[model samples]
Target: MFFRQHRYSNLIIPISYFLDLLIINAFASLLPIQFQTPVLFHAYISFGWIVISLKNEFYKIYRYTKVAYILRLIFTQFVFFFLILYAFIGFFKQPMISRLALAQYFVFVFIAVFTIKFLNYISLMRYREKIKGNIRNVVVIGENKKTNQLISVFKDRTDFGFNFMKQFSAKSLDFQKEECFKYIIENKIDEIYCSISELQNDELTQFINFADNNLKTLKFIPDNKKIFSKKLKFEYYDYIPVLSLRDIPLHNPINAFLKRAFDIIFSLIIILGLLTWLTPIIAILIALESKGPVFFRQNRNGIDNREFYCYKFRSMAPNNDADQAQATKNDMRVTRLGKVLRRTSIDELPQFYNVFFGTMSVVGPRPHMVKHTNEYSDKVDKYMVRHFVKPGITGLAQVRGYRGEIESDTDILNRIKFDIFYIENWSMFLDVKIIFQTILNAFKGEAKAY
Candidate 1:
């Protein structure tokens, strides 16, 4: 009776994703360069494309969009889509993806997708009418603040096509459930917004049954207290219901896998290409400057409160307070070589092995000392949330001048804030951005790095 229903419309994007690929390959066949698939290509595109789409939220639609909006989404989605595509090709060591063909494919795809958007927009416009054809009459059956807010929203958002009907106070027992249902029928009400807290269980059940039996929609209006946090979402299993805070993005499986995949590849490149020759020279420098071992190892808290021996070049000489105290500026324990290592950020490079071993990541919350982890989790808000993702060699906090020794509670608080933000809103693009910024900051040298 309203605008449209999209029960099967979810298939449009998935089908179009592959259709664009086929059109690209068709035109690419005309060129001298050929696109060939590797053994992993089947495993990747078969299930991975759908998983990537799900991660990128390319399918879910809560409302219709203008053609411009759809075009923007298409461009952004394809950028990420191809980012993962190229990542897979490089990670699996597959045959070369044809650059010319890939470019031509998108050119054609943009044109085709552009046309498709206008068609969808036109179809939606054709379906929507000004009066009863595309509008729904809804009423509020409660007198609470939340109910008022709901009514106000419906009244104001004319684009939603909600025609605000009369509201009745649930306090007035004069309006019984039967009478309310009768009123809804008389008014041709399309939805009933009821405050569950205001109604008796039996009365609520009666409204529910009536709404179902009458083919009218019923939406529960929850009091603000029940919501607690804006991040909470509801899910159902069989008949049981559950409310959960939305999982941080890095904690999601597809996202975690992508981060780990990049970690392994990036770590291997440094370990094999750079470390192969650079390690022994740094080892000699450490041996000459210090009396103890070439590497310093200490336990640090990792993902899920687990502790692991994080590695670093032995910057500070052997000290009894190594694990308990943080390094201070002009500390005697720091050797000349150690000062250079700390200043240049080379001391943190050994953690690349942690990344390769799956214990850490290349970009994340910098691992805290076990003592600091225990101390700050109590003092800071949402500090433990940082541990939700693997600790990193460098992170958003480090590049943003929140790195190094904590001089005040404000320092740790700000650092934890950035760490939590990175965990909650992570993306491979963000990781890359953080990595580049970190490299730039390293060259500039951090004053409080010690």
Candidate 2:
């Protein structure tokens, strides 16, 4: 009944994931050179993939994620798959197959899965954009700036697949809950978003009863101006109730260890492999073009709103305003060599040191200058949520073409949306995806990369 009532809203990412593996194995079997492996080996491999992928949250796709983000996710899944596969093998006393044949299997299966998923992603995105596909009828049950903002975003971005059905004021609905219920039932609304402040006591009771009876989705938006975040956690203190607004996954011990280990290992690879030679070349170029420190350090907001000196190659000449001023396109402060560095994002390489030192992550919400943080926190509600995780050199917002200068209020607003999405749906797979997407965007050049 629930599945029938919420048709098209339940997008199971795990099904697509399983299909990718199934298709890969199916295609590989037809190849001219096939590895002879025991049936048990394949079954164990399948089980291993399922368990690890779930642990990594490989199947948690947000409603508004784009094609690029989807592909990045698949790329990450495959990247980590080998580690899981071999680790499973390493645990056994006797290996089942030749290393050479297994290598070929890995290569062929990865290529097949990656190609098919990419095509499917492109098709899905196009279908959603032009065909009114995956549309969800949603109604808001509150009157507030945030609710209006939600309506505006959904109305403007059809690609998100939210259909703004109607809104019911709590004050008015308090007297006549059935009126809202009638419209909901008649229209088959899929979800209801209510302001906790507006519908307390009996009004809240009716709202919950109606939704529960109909099996409709219910989401509560906090009414308080200062204290709402992605997740609302409940704790019991000797039977006393405790409510926490934070839902940051990185705070988990295992999750934190996973993320931090990846950050350290990945940063070390870059620092050793590329930075060893590339650093001197870039440093010399920067010095030749202008006179200042090779590295630029400025105070930015880090995890938990702590101040840290974020390091990047000095892409701009010495300026007293560097602390407060943002770099805009075609700015005179940027040198010729600086332009190349910024375009390729090599300017951010020094921050790998920060990642190695535990001050940053491989992927996260990009930290903003103290001035920008203070300025925007007032303008944007829930803006402080991004600071719950350690800042990153490249983030979901940056890869989604929201990086560089915040020229308008809309720009920052959209950036915050992507950041919040990353926080809410975080995983090691996501960080890997964002890292890959960052590299791809750098090569293709982003809109605000200047």
Candidate 3:
């Protein structure tokens, strides 16, 4: 199974350890300090590293090679090792540890660890070339152009290790009962890749059930390219494999809990501490200008296109529903206080509470009004993918000056480009950078902001 090919490869651990040691040594050699107890310090560091790696699940094999995942692992583990070292050596004021050794340890370890993996990948490629290993005997259960492409790909890139065993046409198969099972048994199949659209619902279900019962691997390659499903990890029940798409990036229990904790702390500081003071000032100004409500509420599309009422300071006339025209520069709709609120982004202060409630994120693709969503989604290609994660108070597009009126289709399309790019290349560092840039942009006063 492609998923389990690298399972239980303790090789990854020792490689990591060697890499860490090399990095530490390199840093140590550059520093002035010398080790009083080199062996004991080395053992303590090595053991601590191993325990940290296990706790972080750095050894668990991934389904595919992703730079993001690997970089994340390296960063988290690097922090853990350094923090532990600092506490044990720096705070305790231990002189036994060499500063040079510590520095070398970090650099060498990281380099060695990733290098070994890269070499291992190269070695595997060579091995596959020699023995024809890693070859996937693919049984594509479709006869569409996509299936034809798959066959062509296999023929073209034998290096990719695909060996097409047979092609199953939906029209020819008698899928009323055990049809897939009978076919598989007859063909001596290794794996099944099915396009859900190629078969009727009942037939697809029957085949899936048969595959589950037989413990065979089932890979779904949907024909709808617009949907943009990703390679997700599967959960098994006995022999049954269940596939999932909405594996929330933050919903990983640890990350979810941590993000929530940060949100609560952050929201508390903003709402009770900061907004408690700013809201009244804004309200008085807003009330004096417009003679209406202090806050505006409207439906915005959230994760998975779910509707949620987003809150903001009433930055326009009280009756401006989402159907009203988008606020434009020097538009008559802008109230005196509304101009300031929108300019400095004081209108978005209410969303801290939304973030606190876990309905919105501090940084993500900025949510659009439900009407705008319906209007622009059709106009912009792959527009719906922006809803893959929770909408944000600000986003990459807004930071890049794509806010305010969408006068042109190109504007909406470019905004969607940044949104999709952010989703595909998301990271904690990216989020932090976006937040920082949003703050800087807020003070600079975005030209597009009405």
Highest TM-score scorer = 1
Cα deviation of 427 in candidate 2 (Å)?
0.8
lDDT of 3: 0.69
For residue 97, give model 1's deviation from the true position in Å: 22
Which pairs in model 2 have colliding backbones?
Answer: none
Q: State the local distance difference test value for candidate 2.
A: 0.74
lDDT of 1: 0.71
Lowest lDDT 10-residue stretch of candidate 1: 1-10
Pairs that collide, model 1: none
lDDT of 1 by residue, 1-450 (tens): 323221133344544556645544444455443446433454554465466557666544322234455566677767775676566657766566766655665566457655665565454445433343356688888887767776766665454456788888889858676677788989888767777668776776667556644546566665434533355544321222223333467644446666777999999999999888888999999988778888889999887667999999899989899999988889888888889889989998899999999778999999999999888776765677676678999998988898888999989988988987887789999999999988887788888877
Q: Candidate 1 or 2, higher lDDT?
A: 2
Q: Give the C-alpha miss distance for residue 99 in model 3, angstroms.
A: 27
Clashes of 2: 0
Cα lDDT tens digits, model 3, 170-224, are 7664533456567675765656877666777676666655554343456655644
List per-prediction Cα lDDT, in the order shown.
Answer: 0.71, 0.74, 0.69
Tens-digit lDDT string for candidate 2 (1-450):
233332323343544656866865564465443334545556766776677667666655544555566677777777787876566556653354456665677787787767766666556656556887776788988887767777776677766666789988876625467788899989988778776767766766666556544545566665453334335654332222233333557644446666877888999999999999998998898889899899999899887677899999999888888887899989888888888889999899999999999788889999999998898776776687787678899888888888999889898999989998898789988988898899898899877878
- The predicted structure with the larger lDDT, 2 or 3, is 2
